[model samples]
Target: MNQTTAGVADDLDPDIRRFQREMAAAYGRYPDFDRLPLTERRRIAEEVRAPWAAGGPVMHSTETLNVGPFGVRIRIHRPDARQVLPALIYVHGGGWTLFSLDTHDRLMREYAARAGVAVVGIDYSLSPEAKFPRALDEIVSVVRWLRSEGAAHGLDPQRIAIGGDSAGGNLSVAANLALLRDGDAPLSAILVNYGAFDRESVYPSYERYDGPEYNLTTAEMAVFWANYLRGAQDFSDPLASPMRAEVAGLPPTFFAVAACDVLADENRAMADRLRAAGVPVMLREYAGATHSFLEAVSISPLADRAFAEASTWLAAQISANNDNDSQ
Candidate 1:
């Protein structure tokens, strides 16, 4: 059954449909969005997403710092004035090209407030200009810095987790892999939300949810990959496409899969692979959700439910990690 031909929009969860409509209307203002240059496109995208990032659970304190040789900027959102706290190092999803810490401000704050941990959002270098491994290197460096120097910022080095959505998800896992290769897997947890795991392979979900109705299309993914990769060979590089990498010995992982997303199948496959590798895996599929659905937390109860569930799971993972560290 080719659901695309049947108009998949008709099958969208009502709240999700509303989100799509609102987002579409916002992007509709820029009729020449696709034809614009990368700089212009990104500027417009920031403007479009400003409304959604407007309001959320305010943090007890927020600080920005430039760390590492590359001066990677990270925004730390602490939920309360704790002398020491566990942290979730969050990477924002923008296909490795768009979005930033500012665009995902609310999302980070929500996690910090709900999960009772500091949310550290890294402003990694974006694609086409930065290329593969550049962002990955910066992320790994930031993790190391947090471990060695984070106490000054009130972060517990041994109780840190890393996570992100879409391309950010891909980097979160790749960073851990980089650490493992260096004989260090210090992260307590990994959170993947509809991540782009495999770049070289096409899955069944692409056919069913690749249309514009889903907010993420196959064509757009192709462009994002091209922008992020330096050459064709990079597609098979495990760090660039984690589905091709070794998954065993990683820490506990939580996957927030969107049932209607083009990346849904890959998220599931990654979860299964992790479980097979004997890693503690928590896979939760959000029914009737689409790509980038979590950004609708301001309006959609489905998005709210998904966040609440992920936060609960994240809190437990960090808490358990804390208890183990005490032992």
Candidate 2:
């Protein structure tokens, strides 16, 4: 099959298609990757992603620290020498089963540099081992910690946002909802990049883009959901599926939707729901983009554009928050 029709639509951006091919080539090396043990699968995944995570803009300083009772490890990337900086608490996506702070290092650095804010990537407990609420709780704890003690590390506690891609995106919203429920202070913003919001209902985009050509398949998502949930009962929990939650009072949200992704329609629905709830929303859909396309920054100009756009929005949100605080 040609690049256009290999695993996605004919309109798939050529650069993104090349990214898919590169990813496929990486996975091709491990023909039995799916059959491997989770530990082995993760090892291979990290190795596969190492090159993509390399050679990004160097940080002014990077620090790794363990926080909370569960000892969640977080990597903080400061873009400049500023003593205090706004922060984006980033969660890395791997179906809640794979990927980590290291695998997503470059993406975090890119955001930190581009947005001129600190980017904090957390090493939340993974699924099947930690399960739902565990990762969500860790994220919530990190945010709380930043609120209480972040100033010691040069973070502006009042100007904090949380974001992630795929599974991480799901956790970002879940954590925000949890904080809201507990009557904790609200976040400044939420950034979601093609988040998997609902696991119970399969949307139209799922069927439309239900092939490996798009980089994410229905079967793979099923496995991911299975790994993250304790049982079928968890499906209805808003924390498990923020799409089913009461989204009122959420802070401003920016959605980076990928047109060819299975999560596209749901992302649109989410943006609509957030708007209906009276939440400020900025929804941008990238034509011909697929899930996880942001990682293609090294090879795709589209990915660079996406990052730049998100960074600009993020910077503006933080700036707006700062201005309000000053006023």
**What lDDT score belongs to each candidate, Candidate 1 first?**
0.88, 0.88
* Root mean square deviation (Cα) for candidate 1: 2.9
Query: Which runs in model 1 stand beyond 4 Å of their true positions?
Result: 1-8, 325-327
lDDT for residue 261 in candidate 1, whole number 0-100: 90
Q: Model 2 reaches what TM-score against the true structure?
A: 0.96
**lDDT tens per residue, model 1, 236-320:** 8999999999989788888999999999999999999988998888899998899988988998898999899899888988863
Candidate 2 off by > 4 Å: 1-8, 325-327
Would you estimate the TM-scores of all the predictions? 0.96, 0.96
Worst-scoring 10-residue span by lDDT in model 2:
1-10
